[model samples]
Target: MLNNIGLPGLLLIAVIVLVLFGKGKVSSLMGEVGKGITAFKKGVKDSAEELEKSSADAARDVTPPPSDKDKV
Candidate 1:
């Protein structure tokens, strides 16, 4: 069903949305949407970085201490 909405359908939808909500409202809404997307991406990146740091720390902790026989 969605695949059937080609360029004309998209244009029509845009026109209807513009008619319902004026240009300024739409523009501001788009700006807010862009900001939201940027924030979401940043959050995801931070989370990934934190996860990597935690994994590295865990790996370091898992290392065994030097044995007495190796203390020659």
Candidate 2:
């Protein structure tokens, strides 16, 4: 369905949006959307880092150091 919407269709949609919500409103809305996207990306990055750190920690805890008795 969306594949049929070419440049003209996008222009029409933009005009309609501008008319319904004035220039300032649309601009602010777009700014908020941008901020939301940035926040989402940051959250994803932090979560991935936390996961990696936890996995590394768990790996260290799972393996014990060799004892002196084993050297015999």
Candidate 3:
């Protein structure tokens, strides 16, 4: 889809956006979007770590008991 937007088309769209929203609103919106993306990434990383920790704990709790076949 984006490949269809050549340089001239992209420039025209950018000019329209600038005229409609101005620089300040666009920059502020971009900043908020970046922050949201960063926060979502952090949340995913934290959840993955927590899942690893819980799986490790569960594995430790499932050890086999010692057999008495050779208690000499």
Candidate 4:
């Protein structure tokens, strides 16, 4: 059903939305959407960096000191 909405359909919908909401409201809403997207991207990048740091720490090799029982 959605596939039938071509360019004309999209333009008509845009016109109706503009008439109902006006230009300023739409522009501010879009600005808010842009900010949300930027915040989401930053969060994902920070999460990936944290994950890499944790994995690297976990991969480090550590050897225990010689125990007294092993001394001859």
Candidate 5:
């Protein structure tokens, strides 16, 4: 389906979009979209770090306390 829309078709669509929404508006929209993607990526990275820290803490808690058995 996408292969059918060649370069000319893509240019036509872009022209139409520019006409419907001025160049400034389109550029601004694209900038906002990029910012949103960056924010989402940052959020996912932070969440992963937090999960790792919590799991490490849980493992430490589950570990048995050291005892004095057969002291040498």
Candidate 6:
């Protein structure tokens, strides 16, 4: 059913929304939506970076084991 809503349907919906909300209200709403999307992307990037940092931190040390002579 939704697939049938092609460009014409979308345009009609947009027209109705614009008429109901007014141009300025719709513009501000779209701006807020854009900001939300940007914030969400940044959050995802930050989360990925944090996970990478944590995994790098958890890596095993490359130094050789201590010799038996070094034992007490």
State the displacement of the C-alpha of residue 61, model 3, in Å, after optimal TM-score superposition: 0.9
lDDT tens readout by residue for model 5, 1-72: 997999999999999999999999999999999999999999999999999999999988986777788364
Candidate 1 structure quality by residue, lDDT tens digits, 1-72: 998999999999999999999999999999999999999999999999999999999988986889999999
| Residue pairs with clashing backbones, model 6 | none
TM-score preference between candidates 1 and 6, better one = 6
Query: Which 10 consecutive positions of candidate 4 have the poorest summed lDDT?
Result: 56-65
Candidates in order, TM-scores: namely 0.83, 0.82, 0.75, 0.84, 0.74, 0.84
What local lDDT score does residue 46 receive in model 5, on the 0 to 100 scale? 100
Expressed as tens digits, the lDDT of each residue in 13-49 for candidate 2 is: 9999999999999999999999999999999999999
lDDT digits (tens) for residues 1-72 of candidate 4? 999999999999999999999999999999999999999999999999999999988778466779999997
List runs of model 5 lying over 4 Å from the truth. 1-3, 64-72
- What lDDT, from 0 to 1, does candidate 6 have? 0.95
lDDT of each: 0.97, 0.98, 0.94, 0.95, 0.95, 0.95
Candidates 1 and 5 compared: the better one by TM-score is 1
Candidate 4: where are CA atoms >4 Å away? 62-72
lDDT score of residue 70 within candidate 5: 39
Q: Indicate whether candidate 1 or candidate 6 has the larger lDDT.
A: 1
Q: For model 6, state the Cα shift of residue 48 in Å.
A: 0.3
Q: Could you give the C-alpha RMSD of every candidate to the true structure, in order shown?
A: 2.9, 3.3, 3.8, 2.2, 4.1, 2.6
For residues 1-72, could you state the per-residue lDDT of candidate 6 as single tens digits?
998999999999999999999999999999999999999999999999999998887675667789999997
Indicate whether candidate 3 or candidate 4 has the larger lDDT: 4
Residue 47, candidate 2: how far off, in angstroms? 0.4
Give the clash count for each candidate: 0, 0, 0, 0, 0, 0
